[model samples]
Target: MALTPGVLHVTQPVDGGVGAYVAMAAADQARRGWRVAVACPGTGPLAAELDRLGVHRLDWTARRAPGLSDAVQAARLRRIVGEFGPDVVHLHSSKAGLAGRAALRGRVPTLFQPHGWSWLAARGVAAAAALAWERLAARWADRVICVGAGEAALARRHGVPGDLVVVRNGVDLRRFRPAGPRERAEARARHGIAEDTPLAVCVGRVTRQKGQDLLLAAWERVAARDGRARLAVVGDGPLLRALRSRAVPGVHFAGAVADVRSWYAAADVVVLPSRWEGLPLTALEAMATGRPVVACAVSGLTELVTGGVGALVPPGDGAGLAEALLVRLGQPALAAAEGVAAAALADGFGVDGALDGLAGHTLGVVAGVGTGAGEACSSSRLRKTPDERGFDEHCQTPWGQ
Candidate 1:
């Protein structure tokens, strides 16, 4: 059989990294003459985002615990697969992975991308139950596609032993480049921030894994020194209400900005203090946009934030986190130098690179394609921190166990 248009069914809401990946894949696949469509819990800004892209939508974000949601979604998607006749079903996030994989049931090839699993993110709130749920989801998978090795390892830890492909979260460098002077000034003006204020920005949902709570705490610590250090947060999540109340004296929450370029342009220092991650898109975006990043040195983050391109701090260390931010904010020349280093670093993760890697991986998963080789070696083998040691590259992680 010849490979053609590939369809991916996502059960999670259309938002965040998974959404971006689907869009890129859809556009690239369309250009390559593949019929691509995404059926998701198209509600809220994410649904609106999908509409802008002219994607196929589905009304099915019904609450699905590992047991109930999985059964309902799987049954519904089984019908969808039969009707749509897709080459493969690509599942995004944990919920979608279990549902989509189980629904397809080998009738068609299924690709599961655990874009941060529920177990890793859901702490103290029945986490063991989530893991149990994932073990069940893995049963229906053809090829498990992990966003990063950390995620892949987590999958393995939970008994998902099989052929796994790790297609990392990537960024489009062309759109997110270093700011030219005119554009930089205009962006600063739009934000009503002075170029001299030393802006710090964090882009992602205000959720637990994103560690906005930690960022808020760190913000207070940083502001205790340079009150001029302004914090500009981008993105919204379930934690928006509590995030709004954070009110770090020098921090400004921009809510969810459609065009985040202005914020990226205005920022001299960028931070992603996530408690856990698969492979964060924000760190790549910040590096791609030519900003100095200060991210936690763990998981997939250790893979990126290498060299002298960015700074890294251990996760959950509030004082260490504050010190890392302050060090960069205090030195304009050094921050600019790091930004330039980041610009050099950004060239590695082009959209073309991602597509070349992703398209093959994706199509193969759908069409039963294979490299006929074992899984790729993980960067975790390299024991080093993110700094002058050549670990401070593009910092992040999104999906987890």
Candidate 2:
């Protein structure tokens, strides 16, 4: 008899890194002859990409949290899980994770990937309620997997314990590897930048969590140091108009390009100035593209950007970030060296590592490694009625508790 391949993953738009992580995992699984199905909101680049790779994608969009839309999505997912007959449920994002676990409870083993916890993102009275709700919902999951060690630490801090898998996200080096000088030159020229101009790329959603405003502020400082230094940001969000309006000199918002790989190939440096994150794909792709990263030292950024790959500054320290950017700007040779080191560091985060880690953890969960059939992860933050104040409290610290 042959081993059966059946895996079900739940997520949202699948546009950003969180989405990219699942997409890559499914592709790797497919290569290994696993039957993987991803249930997300609707059709977009993510859905299309999954289709291209022959992974099943269901039409389901679980909203931010506790909305009528979310309720419906959860019901739909419960139905989908029954229909798919999956061996494991890997849920991504807040709403998807909570709802998937709730739906599959007492029947299927669940593994949740908190791409970024909603408990850490929500704030105020509503936030308190949300945090409490997160704790209540956590009881449904068999295991909570954190993509970055920082997030795994946070899971322990929050009380989601036992069998908590720390799986660092991965990148496809083949798709994002460094282009030849000729290839790089053509990409930069197509973007209309001189061959010798200083260029740094910021790739991610334009949101508060991603710290786009901070990048804008940092760009203001970078322009003061070198006017020739051009910053191009890829990806769009609610703040697109506001970010564009507040744009400083030498800043260009590319507005969510289709081929993000090209953006990496066209830059001398890449920056992920997110206020909060969990093994950001932007940094991974940049490193895979062999570009120096000037980023905030939060989440896994410092862990991955070590050894001359680039400079890591304190999360909210604007001056330190500016200084780091200037260091790369003034010394092209240094930036190139950093890029090489970054590529080497990023090589460690390829698809194989992430999938193997995820597979091992999921297998363990299926084998009943930790947490009882109906229990919760370690955390005082776990709640039933939406700990709005607690959620608010966590959200105040940009790093996300």
Candidate 3:
């Protein structure tokens, strides 16, 4: 009889996209009857959701940034790994990726997923250091799972070597679906938004990377052009207070909400002016909810927001950002048409497919199989039956090899 495979997911940011991804993956693994455990801080939505799902959780208190405590953090992680005895270790985001690899040191099958390359978020000496760390740490990872093709490309461009695979991020289609007129009206009423007001929703952590400041700068122009337009900046972060202090007219800071779907439903268009990303969950969720997106032309955003479905302005181009939002807000028919196309595109990125692809890779790694260097495998190519414990003979060669 085959023993149930065990997976341990270690993560640091336990609130935004990374946290949500961990929660979804852990829950899915548990439902499949695998022994799944998550090592994360005992706070935020990740911990709360894991507890609700009845998955075992170990308190792994770690900060978002590396510091003197990282050595201690790695030691604690090593101890947790010893106790859990997982068949595979999956580290999420940069902080966990850093500590997990250092702790395990390739002693076990390990997967490192940098939701976004840490170097992209750093500057000067910090950026160089981050890139160097990633290049060095690649040897510790059996497989580096990238959330999108752009992420994998970035790694190769920066000479970060590893067996890389792109598993495009997916959204919960059931939870975020197209909002009809009645549904839209109800969502607006629920959020206290006027039915007639032009609304553009931005959902993400209010940090430099997420670019709430860029959005606010663009909103100034958007408001100047159209006084009736309203923008809601959702989610909370360290920059929330600083951003709110600017006091841009017709802008509402919703803070952090338990549910972001209603905000998507209440929007004429969804906007993301992020400086960088690796297939942001906000863009996927908004598209799945049938809303047009006006985002900067960054890595992940460029792939998701095509010409027909939405507009992509160059990163930090405030005038272009404002123009894109204004075009969508002023032309409801065009926005609605683009939204229908957006929903159609989002159908191809269901959460089930993404999770299944991840499971296939996990099982493959446990069985001592690795995908070819820099290969991007989709769920369709990597799908396995529920009863399957590991890769079959056909899956041994890696997709497209």
Q: How accurate locally, in lDDT, is each candidate? A: 0.72, 0.75, 0.88
Q: With candidate 3 superimposed using the best TM-score fit, by how many Å does residue 53's alpha carbon deviate from the native? A: 0.9
By summed lDDT, which 10 consecutive residues of candidate 3 come out lowest? Answer: 386-395
Report lDDT (Cα) of residue 6, candidate 3.
92
Instruction: Return whichever of 1 and 2 wins on lDDT.
Output: 2
Worst 10 residues of 1 by lDDT: 386-395
Return the clash pairs for model 3, or none.
Answer: none
Candidate 2 residue spans exceeding 4 A from truth: 369-401
- Scored against the true structure, residue 399 in model 2 reaches a CA lDDT of 23
TM-score to native of every candidate shown:
0.88, 0.87, 0.94
**Candidate 2, after superposition: displacement of residue 372 in Å?**
14
RMSD of each: 5.0, 7.2, 5.1
Q: List model 2 lDDT by residue over 133-251, tens digit each.
A: 66776777777777665676665567653455456677787788976588789898888888888888888989888888888887888898788889998889879999899898788
Report the lDDT tens digits of candidate 1 across residue range 1-401.
34685576575646666667766666677677776777776565656766777666666664534555567777877776776777877777777776776566666777777777778767675887777777776657777766666666566656756666666666787789987567778889998988678888999878888898998888888888887888888888888788788677777888877778888888878898988787887888888888888888767676678778777788888888888888888887898888888877767666675666667776667656654433332122233332212212222332221
